[model samples]
Target chain A: MKNLNRRDFLKTAALGAAAATLGTKSAKASEKLLSEDRLGVLVDTSVCVGCRHCEWACRLAHNMPSPALDYYSNPTVLKEFRRPDKTALTVVNEFENDKNPNLPIHVKIQCMHCDHPACVSACIVGALTKNEDGSVVWDDGKCIGCRYCMVACQFQIPTYDYDVSIDPHIRKCDFCTERRKEGQLPACVNICPNEALVFGKRSEILRIAKNRTKRKPDIYINHIYGESEIGGTSWVYIAGKDFNELKMPPLGKNPAPGISEAIQHGIFAYFVPPVTLYALLGTIMWVTKRRNESADKDKHDHHSDSHDHHSDSGRDPYRTSGHNTYRDSGHNTYRDSGLSTDKDTKGDNL
Target chain B: MKPAPVKHRFFTPGVIILAVLALNGLIFLAVRFISGLGAVTNLDNNTPWGLWIGVDVAAGVALAAGGFTSAALGHVIHREHYHAIVRPALLTALLGYTFVAFAVCVDIGRFYYIWHPLIMWNGNSALFEVGICVMIYMTVLYIEFLPIVTEKFMGKVNLPGFLETFNEPADKLLRMLNSGLSKTMFIFIIAGVVLSTLHQSSLGTLMVIAGQKMHPLWQTPVLPLLFLLSAIAVGFPMIIFESLIASRSFKMKPEMKILSRLGSMVAPILGVYLAVKIGDMFISDDFKYILKFDVPAWMFMAETGLIIIAFVLFLSKETTRSPGRLFLASSLVIAGVLLNRINNFIVAYKPLYDPVAYFPSFGEISVTVGCIALLVLIYRAVVIYFPVISHK
Candidate 1:
């Protein structure tokens, strides 16, 4: 008995340790794929001319519908702030520069591709995944077009092909994944006339962003927009105007999925909670069934001794006996059923 | 002592209306599959989920929680008096889950890929947890309902004409299944309750990922707990309401004794839900949103107000004992839960670039109404043919 008791304690201790590990697994596993030398883009709104050349180049590269490159130069369209939609994978929006009224800040809007991407966490079918290269990519074959990614995105970058009935696609910026395979920069970076968009290793470009901000503190805001928002993003921004005024959503340092995943893991750690609940319910059912059975026996035998003799029997007899009581109680519980007509008629009047 | 099939005419003026409503829904449902969700639903890139998800799927799941709650009370607690409500509750859950699955299929862009979630699992996703648990629970519900089928046909497997030769064999199979299930049903019963707790809470976790998009009034870390508690609280009222309506429809005596007892237990559950909901609001300092009294605030008020009113009603002996008062109280809770789900999924979801506030399109409303009408029709049909409701 002592040996068995020791073994049981050891087993429970191991299980408890495993459950503790499981509780923290989600946060750790999600971070394991993040690489130090991951590619990223630095967007300097101070340098961007709002020429919209990157917009034309992005469309041409993506093989999506676009007019001539000259059509993008038409500044009239930039009058109204445009978001990156199904048609445009990236767009440059002009913001009012309060410091220098003549020179407006043209902030490019696209997928920030967070280090801890919420879309990847929220995707029901693992359709979206964050790559080691710092690009959050979507698989065509995997997407069910639920558009939960739209709801989860802090930037609201993903757009659905809603009008298309058959094989509707979830459209979003893929950070020029195809072009990068051929050792080329993103189309936006390639077409930037003023070097407003810088593409390089995330850590390296972050250093450059900090240097530029320190060198020209009067010109650029001290804070780098995406350095730590939602646990950092691939696209870092150095802008002259306030980021909040630029319509960049203010987010905390914690990842979008942090609190939610913590709760999820807590509830489902090694499935212990569920199994324990099941066993607890089973025990309650067993004990209560026996008590009810003994009560019923007491009623029938009209003797306390026989009721006590009914003992905690095996599963087979107890289950069958429980059903027998259920069958009998159908009448006793519904005793008012036979007399409910007049009362029900009155009840119906309400 | 045994439950027998209710003997009554199937159709009436109210039923005709329901049939027409269902027909209207089917037409719209067909339009959706053919023309795409954009053609029928008010959903766009900004607002992805609307009436179909909020009312049809979320509210449907919440309202159908009677199955596990009753099972817990009747079988697990061994309250033999409540066993009469179990079969009906099981049937309701089975049908409700079926409706939820169908709504999901319709809501998703690629309906054929619906089975992908079963194979392709994402542990990080709250939705994935909800999807998996709901799938397994549906299967468990079916296994639990098999006893009713075997009981109805075990000794009476009489086939007609050419099939008559196989009647004895069929009877034997039924008997075998009956014996096997009688021994094994307890496993499925406990499993159903466990799964219900898992997915019901995970359903709340679904909107937690929405973050800033969700109004602060409803958005909190404790949403899952609130959702689970609300689901349990609403469970008994749903059973009470269904029992009263079923009896009235069949022109039979309602099981007032059991229903009244069920009613007495409701106030405490609702109280727990209220305490948690209000407590979370105060602790999180989200009570400030409630003071705003804007549309979202009013919607929140309406949601909690219904539950608060129902809770007060349930606390009184006058309400629990009187069938009319109990019915009214139960309806309030059901409506409150329905509104709460809609508020959580639709009204509270304020996305960036929302040009206009989303309202359900006419097609969307028709489809939602049609599904409920169909569910009720099916419930009526099943109880008339099967021994679900107990009576003398």
Candidate 2:
């Protein structure tokens, strides 16, 4: 017993060392893959006027259908606050303060384009893709239209056209990928007359956001929204009020996608579970087969014992006399019916 | 009478209702394509996703987890005690995923581009894995049900001359096929188990991106654990309920002896889930929210209450043994999972500076209902045609 215990302990120790070594190697590889040069956007809420140019530009740029409600006709629309839909990629909403009685603040709502996007992580079909250039995009061809991305997104930026006859796709802001490729700004950024939105590299935007805070400490909130929220977003904001006051959700510094992925990847990192499960199943089937064999043997032994008893009665159990044959035929009838397990037993022969 | 082996096939009540729903659903889908998502859905810029997503697809996948969990514990673990309950669990999971696929078809804006993910490889996105897994998993589920098809159609049947050529000594052929299929069953089962685990947990991770928008009661690093555990907790109970209904309806022997045993095993997992949930809240100081009587706080209480009720119902051997009680308990467990998902994704989630709220349009609700109705129709068809029940 002692020897067996020592051998098992040594075996476990060796396996542990191997597992640790493999784990470190994978971690090192992952570290190398993590991108450092993240891109982002800067929004200064202090200098903003409520103009719906972003909405118009977004629709036109994407070739999406025009909205039924005229942008100019609905002056209070901003006051009502709008959300980005399948058609409308971005919207500007007004927030008024009853106490201060200042001009209502305008906040633009669009896809935040997170540094590590949850939609990207939630997409199983690779429909939602994150580009190396820091823009999170979508590919409809691969999408089975399971809107998991919409459910998983913290910003809830992606919208689906549920009314489409056959194949509806997820619609949202894509950081104006085409325009960015042509060295142009996103439609929203290009159309913003007040310069409320600033488009640049994430590092540059972070610098600009910080400089604004340093220049006028009292005018803007110190923190930048999306800087570290959900592991950061391309669209960062400096708001007039606390983030929660704006109804901004509280998020952790780490990517929400990462937390869930860690557990998912950990348990099923490779084929550990599948292999283990098979080995266990095979063992059970093997055991059940053995039990069946033993049950068969027990029945065979009982039949032989019963045959000895019939022969000892001197009844000529194996004879072919007419009376004997008649009884033999009767006994064989029951045996042929699959109702008798004991092939050699006779109740009256003894 | 053997019920003519097949039921009357032309325009059955179930089929008629599905046909009507399909017509309406197709029309709504048309409007969505022509006018874009804004035309039909109650979704907005602030609330980007709606019921088409949170309820139909994401929650649907979570519910379908019954198949993998039951298969793992029953077959892989060599628990003959659980064998009686496995088939029904797989059936529920199979139907759930079929519904998910239907929901997905109705949920996206540009439906034509749905195949892009399979053609492309975007490993970075969690959505990528979710989509691929769901697609592959659905196919796997259908394959898993093939034996039922074989047992019903091929077993104890006379083949025509042409057909008989393929199945000389058909019994031997079937036995061979069964054995061959069994030998490699582990591969499919393993893939199914792994994929289910990935996507169910990914469902929780999907919400982590929302950050501050989500209520504190739900937001945590332990979301994956919570989702997977909840899925497993609901799995056995789902199987039990299905078995009870099928047996009672079909006038067959109730597999209560085995089902109750499985329920006993599942009860502790529920207890562990609740403990971990509370423990996380306490450790993170997020438990403070539970003290408040606000919507978020009340929702948390209600969610936990339902789960605890399910746990209590299952824990007692007497209640677990009773079919009615077992069914009710499992239903509650499933309800608890749905409510938790809705709370995390919709009810408790609030976007910044967006006063606009969402309520699905009549058309949106209709489409979702249609998808669910289709699942029922398919389930009915499969059950009637396949020998899902054991032949004693």
| Cα TM-score per model | 0.91, 0.74
Q: State the C-alpha lDDT per candidate.
A: 0.84, 0.67
Q: Docking quality tier of candidate 1?
A: acceptable
> Which TM-score does chain B of candidate 1 obtain?
0.99
lDDT of 1 by residue, B208-294 (tens): 888788998888767888899999999999999999998888887878887998999999999999998997776667878888989
List candidate 1 segments past 4 Å from native: A1-25, A303-350
lDDT of 2: 0.67
lDDT of 1 by residue, A1-350 (tens): 12113432232232244433553566677678899889899999999999999988999899999998888888888889788778998998988888989988898999999999999999999999999999999999898888888888988999887776789988888999999999888998998999999999999999999999999989998999999998899999998878999989887776787666767776788688998998999999888878766755643453222222322222324434443544566544433334311121110000
Clashing pairs in 1: none
DockQ of each: 0.32, 0.21
